[model samples]
Target: MKRFVLLVLLVALGGGGYYAYRQQHSAGQEARASAVAQPRAVPVEVANVELMTVAEEVEALGTLAADEMVVIAPEIAGRVIELGFKEGESVKKGQELVKLDTAILSAELKQAQADLGLARDTHERLRSLVSRGSGTQVSLDEAIAKLASSEARVELAKAKLAQSTIVAPFNGVVGLRSVGVGDFVAVGKPLITLTNIDPIKIDFRVPEIFLSRLKVGQPVSMRVDAVPDRTFTGQTYAIDPVVDINGRAIRLRAAIPNADLTLKPGLFARLAITVDQRLNAIVIPEMAVVPDGMGKMVYVVDGGKAKRIPVELGKRLPGKVEVLSGLTPKMQIITAGQMRLRDGSAIAIKDKPLRTSQL
Candidate 1:
C-alpha cells in the first residue's frame, strides 16, 4: 500500500521534477513508521534481591523518671530556723536538710526532764517507806502511777523535739529550697524536692500483642532530645500485669544507670525494643520500591519489559528495605526512570545489575 501511494505521487509530480520533495516526504514517513513500530525504552537500573539479617523491633513513646522522687515536706508547722543542705546538693540518707525553730520544744523537753527526775526520787522514797511499813500501800501505788506518767511525758517531749529537724529520707540530690530561714511554713508544706536519679527509671507502653515477648530483663535502647546524639540502654525492670483495656497496651518500665549523672527525669524518650530477629530474609534497596496507592509496588525488568509487581515490605534499615513478598533472588528491578514506565513498558538499564549488598 505504501509503494502504491509513492508510485501515484511520482506519476503526478513527474519523478525528476519532484525529486527533492520526494526525498523529504519519504524521510518523514520512514520516521513515523519507526515510531509506530517501536516505542522509546525508559532507562533504569536494577539490583539483585538479597538476604539480610535484621532485628524485628517495636518503637514506643516513653519518658525518663527519677528512680525515686519525693517532695520534702514538714510534718509540723514552725518557723524555719536554719537550712542544712545547699540547693542541688547530694545528700546522704538521714542527712539533715532543714531545721525548724526549737525554742518551744526545747523548753518543754527540759520541763519534762525535770518532772521525770522528781518522779524518780519520789518513787524511790515511796518504795523504801512501804517496805519499812512507814507508808500506806495506797500512797505508794499513787506515787508509782505519777512516776509512770512523768516518764511517758519525757518520751513524748523527745519525739516532739526530733520533729524540729527535717532529715533526708533517702540518698538523693536535693532540689531548690522552697522555704528560707524565718519563713513560717505550715504542716505538710513542701520544703524542697529530692530525687534519686542514679539508675533512673523509664516508663513506656507497647501493644498487648508484644506481651508474650516481654520479660523482666529484656534489653531496651532509647534516645532523647535532651541528650542528643547519644543512645541510652537499659533492661526492662517491671511490666504491668494487667493490660490496658482501652488501649490494649502493657506498661513497661526499664532502669538505665545514670552513673555519669547525665540523664534527667521527665525527658521525652524514643525507645526501640528488639523483640526478635530474622535471618535469611529477602531484602532490597528502599528506593526500588514505590507506592501503589493500595499497598506497595516495584518494577522488575523481565524479557526487556517492566513488570510492575506489588510487594509487601518488612523491616527497614538505613538506605535499604526488606521485601517480604512478591520478589525473588536475582530478579532484575527497575530502580530508576520508573515514573514514565508502566506494565510491560520496554526498559533500557542505565547501570549494570548489582546485588542488594551494593545498595
Candidate 2:
C-alpha cells in the first residue's frame, strides 16, 4: 500500500511540471507576436538647429529713477508764508519753491544788529576813555570782547534768517505741495518732491557671473509696461564695483534719454543688455524645449527615431532660445509634437523640416 501511494505522488508531480512548461511556452510565443507589431509614428513639426549670431545678454528687472531725486524739505520750523512755485511746474536750479514766515527771525536779526551797534559804540567810548586815561585797560578789554560777541550773534541771526526760504537744488519738476500758506511745518518735513527726469537713470542688477561682460557705455534696451509700444535705448553708464553678498548680483545704472519726457521716475522697467555676441551660437525655437524637472531637454529626430537630449540654455530671444550644448548645427528637432514623444520613439514629420538656412 505504501509503494502504491508513492507512485501516485510521483505521477502527479510529473503532470504539474508538464503543465507549467506548456504555459511558459505559450507566454513566450505571445511576447514575440507583440514585438513584431509596429508602433504608430508620432506626427511632429521639426526645426533645424542653426548656427547664427545671437546676442548674449543679461536680463534683469529694473526701476526707472530720476537722474537726481530728492524731497524738498525746510531746514527750520516755521509757518508757510508764501508758495514761490506752483505744483507740477518745471523748476530751475536756485528757484524758490516755498517761503516760511520770517517775522520772528527778522525781529531777532534786527535786535542782534542793534545790540551789535550798541556794543560797538560802548567799546569805542571805552577805548577813547582809556586813551584819555579815564577808563581802565581791563574795562576797555571787556568792552571790546562784548562787541566781538555781539557781532558773532548778528552773523548767527543772519544765517538763521536765510533758512526761511527753500529753493530748488536742481533743474527738475516740483511735485504736489505738501504745505500751504499759513500751514506750520517742522524741520526736515517733506514739503515737496523734486525730480530731474529729462535724462532718467535706470537702476538694475545682474548676476555676478556676468561681471566680466559688463562695462560703461554698453548699449542696453529698456521696456516699461506703462509704455508697451515703445522701446527706450540707453548705455550702461555705471556699474557697482562690489557684488551684493546676499544675492550674488552686481548693480548697474543706465542713462535713458527722455527728451520727449515720456518716461517718468518710479516706472517699472525691463532691462536687457547684450554683454557679448556669439556668431556661432546654436539657436533653436523656444517651443522645442521640454521642461524636465529642474532642467530642459529637446527631442532630436535622429535616424527617424526620437532621441531625447538634455540641453543647457543661454539667453532667450524673441521666439527663440540659445542652446549652449547637447545640440549641433543642422540637427532636426521635433518642435510641435514633442509632447507625445519619448526616447527611441518613432516620429513622422508632418511637413518638410525647417532648413538651417531659412531658420
Name the top lDDT candidate.
Answer: 2
What's each prediction's TM-score?
A: 0.64, 0.61
Among the numbered candidates, top TM-score falls to 1
lDDT of the structure predicted as candidate 2: 0.90
- Rate residue 175 of model 1 by lDDT: 93
Tens-place lDDT digits, model 2, residues 1-359: 99999999999999999999999999999888887777778778887887889876778998898998899888899999899888888889999888888999999999999999999999999999999999899999999899999999999989889889888889988889778899999989998999899899999999998888898998899999999999999899899998999999999999999977899988999989989878999989999999999999999988999999999999788899999999988799788878778899998887766444433
- Record all residue pairs in model 1 with backbone atoms less than 3 Å apart, i.e. clashing: none
Record all residue pairs in model 2 with backbone atoms less than 3 Å apart, i.e. clashing: none
Off by over 4 Å in 1: 1-55, 277-316, 319-359
Q: For candidate 1, lDDT tens digit of each residue in 197-253?
A: 999999999999898888888778999998889998888888899899999999999
TM-score, cand. 2: 0.61
Model 2 worst lDDT run, 10 consecutive residues: 350-359
